[model samples]
Target: MKQLYISFILLSLSFSNSYAYQNKTTKAVDKIVVTKKTQPTKTPIKISNAIIANFVNKYPNLKTYRSDLNNLYLKRNYKSIWFGGKGLIEFANLLYAKTNELEQEGLQSKFAYKNKINSIFTEKTTKNLASVDTELLLSAMYLFYAQKVYKGIESDKIKEIGWLIPQKNLSYATLLSYLLVDPKALDKNDTAQFNQYYKLREVLKKYRKIEQNGGWNKIVRDTLVFELKPGDSSQTIGQIRQRLATTGDLHSDSKSNRYDQELIDGVINFKKRNGYNEDPVITFSQISRMNIPIENYIKTIMVNMERCRWIDPEMTKAAQYIIVNIPSYKLFFVRNGKTELESNVFVGGTMNETVIFSGNINYMVFSPYWNIPTSIVQSEIKTALEQNKNYLVENEMESIKGRVRQKPGPKNPLGKVKFIFPNSNDIYLHGSPSKSLFQSEYRAYSHGCINVNKSEELAYLILKDNTEWPVERIKSAMEGGKEITCMLKEKLPVHMGYFTAWVSDSGEISFFNDIYERDDRLAEILFSEDYN
Candidate 1:
């Protein structure tokens, strides 16, 4: 009886302890629930139409985003997108990060309210989310980024700078939809912009870092010309070596102050890259050009990047295309995504700048007659006729349509052949009777047409696939002394563009003279405070 009594007591004591513990545990759980319920979490703000209207009216600079923002809100029924049921969307953070990296993306433009927009992230608060300012600012920034990166300068501004290529219009609605689906849409959709822009963007970063670290020393310009020759030692020689080393044109700075063989090779490389005819002696003009601040080169690179943005990326990837860069005075024949041939070319003079446009080369005229333009006839030929009555016969000239045209002969201005792309500009690629011009470094003496140094080789390449026109037949046609027009089996696209900075297939950066001074006008517009 005593054992049973003792066991019952222990069991009752255990049950009492267990009951108290259960009550304590239940109260702790309730406390946690209460705490969670009282926590001050951010409540998503309602994006009402009235609030949007008020914000839009207050921030007039963001007019570009107004229509798109309105459509976005109406579609979502006035719910905040950047800020959601959970503080902020992931895509909002992504867009913010991209805006911060505008410079690295080759954009020098600024957002008017960048600071205010950035503060939203730093001083993140529920109240900030409640208002529409943050969202509207983000919208504006997105437009600005898109404009500078994908769209480039405004259409009117491009037209003012004489860019005839069609401007690509990026749809904000489509971009937003893509972002909603994948916040990384911007980087993934790089194909929308020219690939060269990205390549140059990488190059730009290196140049920018170099600029920050203090660019190359300016070469002396007071001297008439740098009479630099191998084995010549002088103060100017030392400066030249230093300049070349700074630009990576020379392997290293020997500090010897001697114009050695290494310096000669370096000068040749520099001259070739700068569109100069390679020469043994460095000229005064070359020294003056080297003296130009590296900052100017940076600006040129930026300007060409803007040009790259203007191009259609797909056009560059065509199976066969001919691209003529007027500023560089070079022509590239690209086939199957590789540069098959490059030729030195003569473009227009300053007064007769080549037009920036694209055309399809479908015809070739062998032994083409040089029908002198009316402008040339009036300005030059008429006076020559008065000076020499027999000048017509002397030049193998005849009258047709009240205009003088050189007959098909060795003396004809259009040597051997010409490739025609029908256009209103009346420009065509042809061989020049002044073949000596091909040897000159600065060969921009033509009226407006382009003269190919290797015109015969170009003809052979163009008609290579056609068994009917072999090299012999082509040569025969060119020398037949009659104007013969033949249509191509396939029309090749030819793009005549003006770019002062270019990157070759081997990743060498080449700079050319801005013959028409187009870069200055573009820089003015690009650096304007009012630029959008």
Candidate 2:
């Protein structure tokens, strides 16, 4: 009985020693979550849920994020994510730097409690471990930065600025967990964001670098010089060469005043990218275009990046879709992840601006009679009849049930074919009888519907897989004697968008005229938070 009692005591002592030594020898990184005041030497890296609740109460600036803060801590079981046992974690420094550099994400302002947050990082005023204020402030700043960069301005505000594209539903609180695990996720262009956003981000960095390098000087046009062409020599030509070189349009700057073949090639390339007629002549107007300040370009980039954030990143994965960019006056047809065709298009006039929205191409109408809208019939047709009694006869138009209808022929404005999409706006894509307007750089003469330059080609591309409507059949249907409608096997998605700045797959950055003047309105909301 004495030996048995001794053995039992030894077994109990061994169990006690093993239990005591398990977590004691582990490092802080091994997640030895100690409660506050439990260990004198180690400041607890985890705190009570009440700590977050009380911290947000003291900081009214973070009051907007009270629920988000609570939800984050609750998910982590009240662990201090930004703080390790010794000091601030590595992600804390990265996140602080990102908050300070908000301009990279197109934000002009910092978090409201920036000064208080800075005190935690500065050596002179560094806080002790388990700093609740620092912990909570970093949490709030992370939300702000994540919302600005990953999600962008609020959905309603972007809608107020006439952005009809669908907005993303991002959970910044959930994203915090990823950053806690891997800090590098802070800068990675995750698939969650639109692909265009990353492309624009890269371009913004490149343009800012150019701005820091003194930008380009203004070219002075002399009274003696009217137009500059190849073989022409002037100081303005030298300035143009330097400007193109700075923008990566020209291979190199020779610093020569004489306009050579190299300068001519650069001029054409610049004009092509800038939505202008590709002409070698460098006129006064061209000089003005080249002289727009670099700062404006940077803001333009920022504005477009915000637009990219509003779109679903996975939108481009469609098997086939059509995208019409209003500002660029172009249409792109993509199939199997490749752009099959690109065509010039003319949008609505100022009086009847095209709506920024999306739809599905339901069917195609061949040699269809133009059913003129009531407003156009009253305003335009009546006025034409008042001026000339033979207007209807000359135009091959007839009045039908109080509405005028144009006969499908050479006289019709909607030439041979039109693509119809169901929308309340009564907008559709059609060919133009007068092709002269398509050749113009500023082709916004349409009443409302888009006038496609290559409407027949578009039809063929859309009906390529059908095998029912070959090229010859399509041609016969467009003969204007009878109207015919062909429904698509599957509806093709169509997105009418406006982007002033666009980056092609080849990294070619192009800027077009903001036809609706929308960039400023959005940029104001993004920078000023006027939506609040």
Candidate 3:
């Protein structure tokens, strides 16, 4: 019994000594951690508004962020943020590491005076020479991080790049306020940041890793001789399989040359991912796109990430709203933050590109007239009318003074119903007489408005709440007849936007072609501009 008691005492002492050593080691990143007595040093590195004012002079490049820095100190009563009674908080390392790896955020922007910040961390003794410069520098970095990662470029510059969507304007003061309460708030998913920005950041990491591993190889194809179809075997088929597997479109690469069902499925997945027709046949154009260097794909992702920065996260927070992705050629109806309906859409062609903007949907017109624009009247319909005097009668179009408008009928181009959202662009969502156009993968044939494939289903979904517009009434309304407008009880928000790369909630990343050719111009501006 005596030996057992002695053993217990020794064991407890050993554990107590080990824990003490570990606790000290954990906080020993800098010299200011603990005093000789091993009690936490309670001295706060005092900062004055004068100190902050002097900082802007030393680092005038951070002039823009002087605001959040000053606000942080004043609210904090000129105390430390990166430090505590213990010394440098552990999150300092985390923030420093993140700032170094900006590419992971799809940002090429550099933090101002990054090397000097690096020296402060590496050479800890230097903190003594300066009065709380380290503290202020870290504060400046947090503001810079928030600005680059969440708020993005200046709003006017985004508009200059042809992006008309609303920019996400963030308050650094609020961020600092949150940070003062909990330093870890900096790492949390910010409510103001467009949620997709994180998803794109995740994909950017994967693609950069792909780039590091020698990237994807280009498939050498003789256009005249190289064509892949089901049951046709070639070495090119194996290359295609490997390529699809790189992006996870294919489950596994059999590493076989045969064009089997597995390869066909991979081809379909690749096509769907790239906004191409889901056909098994592999063409030269598809291979050419595949051959586009992974570097280019990375740039596309970066450009889209910049676009995400310009989007207001709250734009989609309404009870019900619709989002039209022009490049992917699809429309999504979201209710209560869940996607309730998805429809294939055909948007404007290159020459008449659909404007990127948002508006409230207030009404829907059943069997609406196609008021042919004056440009088309002078350029097309007028010429046709001159060619054949009976063209108006043949096409069900009427001449009311100088204007030409097609009457609501079976042959009407506006299809059965058109959803109206008043905007300066004069664009809205509507149906088309030609449903076959929706089947084609390259669905950019419209003039300026969007053509929803499931107009009947959309009408039913939109008015499902109203007892007045039941299924029977909706069916009757869709029937060709005199034009009738049904005003919505509540305005539904709709946003028309452009994105060439998108990451689904399930983590599936899709890369769509830049239909409007806007990416290159935007990329040029972003790469050249100093985020500071």
Candidate 3's residue-wise lDDT over 1-532, tens digit each? 9999999999999989966754554343333322221123366577877878888888898887776787777776776777755667666665666666677778778777876676655543433325367778888888888778777777888777766766666777676566556755555554766788778888988898999998998887755665678998777888888898898889888999888998888889888889988889899889998889989999999988888877888887789999999999999999999998999999999899999988899999998999999988989987897899999999999988878899998788888999999988899899888888788978998898999998768888999899988888888888957898999999999998888999999888899989999999888777885543
Show where candidate 3 strays beyond 4 Å.
Answer: 1-50, 74-79, 124-129, 179-185, 188-190
User: Of the pair 1 and 2, which is ahead by lDDT?
Assistant: 2
Sorted by TM-score, highest first, which candidate order results?
Answer: 3, 2, 1
After aligning candidate 2 to the native by TM-score, how far in Å is the CA of 179 from where it should be? Answer: 4.4
Q: List candidate 2 stretches off by more than 4 Å.
A: 1-53, 71-80, 83-89, 126-131, 177-183, 529-532
Which has the greatest TM-score? 3
Candidate 1 residue runs with Cα over 4 Å from true position: 1-55, 70-85, 124-127, 131-133, 175-190, 221-226
| Residue 15 lDDT (model 1) | 85
lDDT of 3 at 134: 71
Q: Is 1 or 3 the stronger prediction by TM-score?
A: 3
The local lDDT score (0 to 100) that residue 246 gets in candidate 2 is 93
The digit string of per-residue lDDT tens for model 2 on 130-192 reads 366667888888887877788877777777776676666777767887777777677765555
